[model samples]
Target: MRSRGLFSRCALVLGLVFLYVPILSMVIFSFNNSRLVTVWDAAHSPTLKWYVALAANEQILRAAWLSIRIALVASTGAVILGTLAGVALARFGAFRGRLLLAGMTTAPIVMPEVITGLSLLLLFVAMEQLIGWPKGVGAVTITLAHITFCMAYVTVVVQSRLAGMDESLEEAAMDLGARPGRVFFRITLPLILPAIASGWLLAFTLSWDDLVITQFVAGPGSSTLPMVIFSKVRFGVTPDVNALATILVLIVATGIGVSTVWMRYQQRRRERDVLLAAAANL
Candidate 1:
């Protein structure tokens, strides 16, 4: 048992190393003073030259902006659509076409990315031919494609949260002469907000990191950050790429940290309010 435990510990450490070592290396190299990313100079100290260069890089800036814009819009849309779907699935149990709706909502999770991308591409083609809408693949197409799959992720998060949620609060509201819509907005929505926020962030990350679907759906002038990174890395590695990656890492980490702290604060505030309310009742 002792030997097995030691082996498990070693395996876990090794897995973490495998996953994070490259990311660590990239972060470290981003500070390298040398022009070449891989080569380190003993004589020269780390400098912010590459970071400065990254700021000046028009292509990278444009791509990053495009990516952020798409992610923000797509995530919002996904969260709205997913929340509606989740509410239907959780609150309206066993309604007509429920099975079909459920299957469609979950299908994107299990489906291959290639298949999803191809189908969306074909869908865009068909839509263009049929209605002459969208004109051609661009930011609109990519955003729609991202929303399609990201909605599935949001749905799963919200559905799981709803499954374990205390429906009593909503029921109590309804019993106290509140309309169903009022109860949902005041009670259900508040309770499930954390899950919705989580789903939104997750959907944003998925959309931001997506390459395969974006590659298929994107047309000229709509290249995202990941697409740009992929193109740069295909030829060879550059220090600018490292600097760009480090910037992205820092941005993502800061967002996550802020969100986590804010969520914890909100949770504590709610708990305090509940305790005060109970004391008042007593």
Candidate 2:
């Protein structure tokens, strides 16, 4: 058991280092003054010229803004649609082909992202031909494609939360003559709120980070932040890109940190309430 614990700790540390090293390197190099990203003069000290230039880089900044806008909208749509699907799956049973539907829901998780991008592209082309909709691929098409995948992630998260919960509270509410809608809004929704919150965050992050699907669906002049980064990276690297990456990493880290602290606080509050009820019974 001690050996197992030691191995686990070692693996965890290594895993963290592996994931963070590239980001750390990116942050460090973002300040390099050389036009060539290959030269990093540690002894001469780093410079911030790239970042200063980034402030005036209108094209890349516009792409970043567009990406952020699309991510927020798509993630919101995914959360609503996915939450409804999750609730139906969790709260309802005895429907024919339920297992098959659940399988279909999860199949996209393992599907290659490239295939997803290609499939979505084809679907959009077909939709355009059929209804003359999505007139040209830009913000609308990219966001819809993002929503398609983000919903899958949200459903998986919410389903897990629902599976872990006790169904008795909802049963009691229904028994007390509450309407099904009321029972869900009052009891079920609140109980699974944390999971829903987590799902929203997950969906947003996935949408923000996606490249393949966005690349396929994006129209001319509709480059996303990732597309901008890819273009810059091909020229080697720049400290401006590094600075932007670091800022993004910090934003995501801060959001995640705040969420974790909130979850812990809520968990402790629930535990305290449980303890108080137990004591009162005694």
Candidate 3:
């Protein structure tokens, strides 16, 4: 038992190390004074020159901004569409065309990125030829492509959340003279708010981090941050890239920390309210 426990602990530590060592190295080397990301110049070490350079790099800045805008738009669009699809699947049981809708929504999640990207490229080209719309691929096309794939994730998340949620609350609200839409907005929506938020974040991250699909859809001047980083690394990774990565890591860590703390506080408040209600009833 002792040996088994030790082995499990060792495996967990190894897994953590494997996952985080590269990130830690990147963070450390972001502060390195040398142009080479992996090399350390102890004489003039731990400089902020790369961070300054990253800030000044117009191309990187432009790509980052474009990626952020695309991610924001894609995630919002995905949430709206996905929520509708989720509601249909969860509430409107055994409806006509249900199987088709379910299959379409889930296809992207299971399909290879390469195939999806290629298909989308062909679709855009054909659409342009047929309707003379979206004349060429660029930010608009990229955003649309992102929305197409990201929504699958949102739909799955929302459907799962709704499947597990108790219908009693919604039914009770409806029984109290509330309309279907009103019951959803007042009762069902609030209960599934966390799932929706999770879906949004997941979609945003997928859209932001996407490379293969973005490459197929993106035109000149539509380079995202991942595309830019891939282009740079093919030649050689510079210190500025490391600096950019470190800054991104810091932002993600901060956001996660803040959200975790806020969630814990909310949980505690809810527990306290429940206790107070029970005591008052007694």
The number of the candidate with the highest TM-score is 3
Each prediction's TM-score versus the true structure? 0.91, 0.89, 0.95
Per-residue lDDT for 44-77 in model 3, tens only?
Answer: 9889999999999999999999999999999999
| Cα-based lDDT for every prediction | 0.92, 0.87, 0.94
Candidate 2 lDDT trough over 10 residues, lowest sum: 36-45
The TM-score between candidate 2 and the true structure equals 0.89
Off by over 4 Å in 3: 278-282
- Comparing 1 and 3 by lDDT, which wins? 3
As a whole number from 0 to 100, the lDDT of residue 180 in candidate 1 is 88
RMSD in Å for model 1: 2.4
Off by over 4 Å in 2: 1-5, 42-44, 263-282
Quick one: ranking by lDDT, best first?
3, 1, 2
Per-residue error for 130 in candidate 1, Å, reads: 1.0
Lowest summed lDDT across 10 adjacent residues in model 1 is found at 36-45
lDDT leader: 3
